[model samples]
Target chain A: MIGVGKVKQYSNVLDKPLSKGKQEVSLSAFAFLFSELVQYNQTQVDNIAELERRLEDAGYSVGARVLELLCHRDKGNRRETRLLGILSFVHSTVWKVLFGKVADSLEKGTEHEDEYMISEKELLVNRFISIPKDMGTFNCGAFVAGIVRGVLDSAGFPAVVTAHFVPIEGQQRPRTTILIKFAEEVLKREARLG
Target chain B: MAPAGPRSGDAIFASAERVNAELFTLTYGAIVRQLLTDLEEVEEVNKQLDQMGYNIGIRLVDEFLAKSNVSRCIDFKETAEVIAKVGFKMFLGVTASVTNWDADGTCCSIVLEDNPLVDFVELPDTCQGLYYCNVLSGVIRGALEMVSMKTEVTWARDMLRGDDAFELQVKLLKQVPEEYPYKDDE
Candidate 1:
């Protein structure tokens, strides 16, 4: 709330300068808050799938916001128009700011050209809560999948995003993978742009 | 290195693992939006938010105790001070001031001039009855209860409601003796 130059009145949020993404809070604070989010949603829904859908919906809005905020602040108002450009942005820029680091790996699907996979050993939410079958894989990743979808969709890339459990040979818990399959129009547009 | 005396709010905040505030702020906003959509009633949303905050407070108090090494034996007055100075700072990266204490020292206000929760937030005309930050009051109440202090916390003012600042009024309702570590030293 520190004023920039002198005492002034801001009639709206738009009037305020966009924060430089410098402010911070302890990781525990966020973890506690996020835990409550999942718990509250759980009470509202009857089954696990419904609960995961609700969590995804919640994350969608956050992803949408982060896209707009980061684009304006960091990219000098230039948005990624190409498929690779946007995916890279989501991988490096969006993931870094939101999760504190780049995602572990972003790989193109060998069988399908229209799909991409983003894998993380332990996503932020996965590290805190223990899921039934695995840690970050099945239940905990829906929200993150939603975030990726939100970013891609709002950026005009309309895609179907899903989360899956990938078992490591020696690891006790399976890591999480986000599978993103782009719509036909998006691929058509990418080909046109190229 | 652990310092000799109790660490200040700034010192603990500097050392703790941190995350981007925008992520936290956006995540909270998303939660509020989801609650409003599901509950429909503003009153119900407030209650749910408070309940969630209470859950967090009960768990967070343990971390607060472990991190902030203040003298254990203190009265309700000092306890409020620590929560304002340390608890808020350690978690939210903000500092609040404890003021306007009653003559008996059973009640006071935690005044926050700048709050991250309210940033970029404006009360829509339809949500006039919503105490958007009820979760904070619930957190204080639940945290105090864990330490054997039954308390009542309410919002006296909110910036979204056009108040100059955010103020939470906390009243010490009862004190049960059960090997409480934060008893007053006399």
Candidate 2:
């Protein structure tokens, strides 16, 4: 047991400032932790959709917090105003901060003006994951999609985000595409403001 | 008056590499909150966290072995020191102090003054029975079990739960020898 006297000697961590130092954690540790999260959520839900919903719910809170923190850290507290600006922020800044690299590409949907896609050749969260045959069409990237939804929703651009796995013939790491569909109201507001 | 050898364990930990503290804390918070909402039972949540930690520990030990160049320790005392100095520092960027060793040296406590996982956490009043940091104990138990050392680990105190300190008690029950069933055929 630590003595009360020792506790008094140490300063409270809350009093310290959050610095802008380049901090990095073990990827293996995070991969293992996330794997357990998927396993736990899998045991709780009956179907793949329910499991993805739960994973998204879990990532939602994180996305909200990350949005606030990242805005403060990288943008000087200025929130992105334009749709392309926010998508760029999510594609480049958010991806770099979270995964230590920029996403592969950001493309506009062919059929819809309000739809956008962000693709990653290899998602950090799914580095150590291997889906079983029983879990048909299950993509752990739903957590990342949930985060994207949370960030967009909180930033006043309400949208629905879904993750899809697209395997390349010769690539070792499979690609994940996050399809983001913005609400009609958002598009109307953007058009009026533009 | 200092012994002429390698520097002390704590000194080594002071120079360890660090990770983005927010990523560690936020992800852990998400996991805990999810478990609470899904299970709705403190005991079940605790069990689930431990089981998850056990699974993580089994895989984590392999990573630890691969990254660390340290050789095997001679005894349990040295083992505790290695775990505190190398394992915790390498993974979490924190050095736990090994203290309160029993007279027989079969049991001791690892005291963590700084825990990244609890940085943004506050145990809710409803989660009275939830052992928020029980995963640490489970990891210790699971990791030690892999090295042929059967041990029991429990949290003696947790700062997140309003305790004065964070202390994990590890007791070495016995050692089990490895058995190869195919050795006779070979």
Residue A164 displacement (Å), model 2: 1.2
DockQ of every candidate? 0.50, 0.39
The CA lDDT of each predicted structure is: 0.85, 0.79
**Model 2, residue B17: what's the lDDT?**
39
Stretches > 4 Å off in candidate 2: A1-16, A19-21, B1-19, B182-186
Candidate 2 on A1-194: residue-level lDDT in tens?
A: 34333543224544545546254455556776788888888888899999999999888888887888788777899999888888999998877777777899999999999899999887777766888899888899999998889888888899999999988899876799999999999899899988
Error of 1 at B167 (Å): 1.0
How much does each candidate deviate at the interface, measured as C-alpha RMSD after superposition?
A: 4.0, 4.1
Candidate 2, residues B1-186, lDDT tens digits: the string is 333223233333344433366766677888999888878999998998888888877777887766665677678998888787677777776667889999999999888766667764666679978899877777888888888899988888887666778888999999888877577757
lDDT tens per residue, model 1, B1-186:
444435357788889988888888888898988888989999998998899889998998998888887766468998888888888998899888888899999999988745777666777988888988888988998898998899999998776776667889999999967785566884
* Top candidate (TM-score): 1
Scored by lDDT, model 1 comes in at 0.85
Q: Which stretches of candidate 1 lie over 4 Å from their true place?
A: A1-9, A133-137, B1-7, B179-186
For residues A150-173, what per-residue lDDT tens digits would candidate 1 score against the true structure?
Answer: 899999999988888798999987
